[model samples]
Target: MPARTYPALSYELYPPRGDDAEESLWATIRRLEDTRPDFVSVTYGAAGSNRETALTLLRRLLTETALKPLAHLTCVGSSRAELTDVVERLIGGGVRGILALRGDAPDGVDPSEGDLQHAEDLVRLIRHIEAPRTAQLAAGRVSVGVAAYATRHPDSPSEEHDIDVLLAKQQAGADFAITQVFFQPADYARLLTRARRAGVTIPIIPGVMPLTSTRRVEKLGSLAGIEVDASLLARLEGARSDAERRRTGVAATVELARAALDHGAPGLHLYTFNEHAAALDVLDALGLERPPEAGTVASL
Candidate 1:
């Protein structure tokens, strides 16, 4: 038999907020570039917030680095026209893939939602608009990725509903999905089982991150509406110093990633949080990901 194929390794980054942060992020970007990730995703704020900053980073990545850029566009608090413009800008800037998301709507804002009500709606829109730009694309099509949930979405009534939504997105033309940050290996396995049983065929990549501190994991759990691992929290809290805490965190993350890969996850999509140390440490520890041989598929 031929050697077993592992899925691609990718990373997620967000736009930096200020000049100092921008400088720091560039340093991290350079370091991550050396890893030759299959694709590096950039997140724009909800309702097209931080649009310019995100655009600048994408443009720089295209020109300054050898990495492929996967731009993130969220459907929330923006009109159809606004979304059309953003999509055009990304296409014109040579972005070949987008991760569609139905982001959180702002509080106290009436009509805080966009014309695109769900991620599936955004998927349809992306396919429809990109139809006219096929000649400019090297692959002759856009690769649109959506988010999958291993746990119940905060607003969703049940896990089955979330799987149904994912099915709808795939039907609407999403090529793949990267799940929200999940803590347990069993979480990813359960999601894959449910999704396959529901007829969702897209390759769903597990999004892993290095939770290097008590506050980092707590904040991510709160934001993603997922439960934090209490034992991992306790371990970090009991660490003798910041360095020890990071060591514990990275070790826990390596175990999580290894288990997911062992469970047959299609790929590893790491959340870099605009910093690279812990993420790199996790990569080094797992040693599961490597550069794909030439002419092989490097991404899911």
Candidate 2:
């Protein structure tokens, strides 16, 4: 049989908190492996709060699984030298891809304290780093990915400014971008229209985070800097119980994913929040249950 593949689908996971959580995370990883995502990304918590744990998980994924793991690097609370060390460590650890981020300021930490100011700056840094391991260089040196904002970035004054930021990162050698979770397909289209007008040609995958719970949608929206569609929000809010809310979330996410794919989104980058069932259900419903044919989608 042909190697299993996915229709350009990817999943995001976060580092676990303890040994038990690590075992659970491995189980989740194994479960998702059957989906054969193009790649899976692991997030470093805000301000590099989970750096060690994230790196540990990345190394484990590299050694223990066939999954391609992309390590997230942030410029929130580290100096340039500190970040350089982290980059070197990743290369030494056999990881080949990175997601450069200007992570949110950790609680009670001023954002200005970091030496690397913007994610674009970190993108530049990653592009220039020399890998210590020849094997890592052969693995493709360092494929740098950056974040894109489908809705305007939280700190950006306008959507145009947000596109410009992404354009700058592309110029700095970002391989591709993954957007923050967004519900409206039009939001992604508008962002892409502006980006293309500005000459950004890199793939921008739409991020999909299922609502999961009506009560948490508002907080999720706020954190992602996205606006929940009023009608969808109403449907979710009107759910009478936890199970009903979850069903509404899954159904709504499936609809949103269909709309996004219909609008020519390159692919979907799911924010799994370390949970796979809802996201897997949404993908299965969309007729993407089988692996994608070879050469149909770009490799990570």
Which candidate should be chosen as best, given TM-score against the real structure? 1
User: In model 1, where is the ten-residue run with the lowest total lDDT?
Assistant: 105-114
Residue 143 accuracy (lDDT) in model 1:
92
lDDT of 1: 0.88
After superposing candidate 1 on the true structure, give the runs of residues whose Cα lies further than 4 Å from its correct spot.
Answer: 1-4, 111-113, 292-300
Give the range where candidate 2 is weakest over 10 consecutive residues by summed lDDT: 130-139
Estimate, for each residue in 1-300, the C-alpha lDDT of model 2 and write its tens digit.
555543478899999998888787788898888888888999988877888889988988898898899999999878999899999898778778899998888888888998988999999888778534445476455778999887877888998888889989999889899988787757777777788899999988888888776556788888767777788888887889977877888888887777777777778888887777877777777876455545687444
For lDDT, the strongest prediction is 1
lDDT of each: 0.88, 0.83
What's the CA error at residue 102 for candidate 1, in Å? 0.6
Give lDDT tens digits, candidate 1, residues 2-109.
Answer: 566656899999999999999999999999988888999999786776889999999999999999999999887778898898899999888888999988766664
- Residue 291, candidate 2: alpha-carbon lDDT: 53
Per-residue error for 65 in candidate 1, Å, reads: 0.5
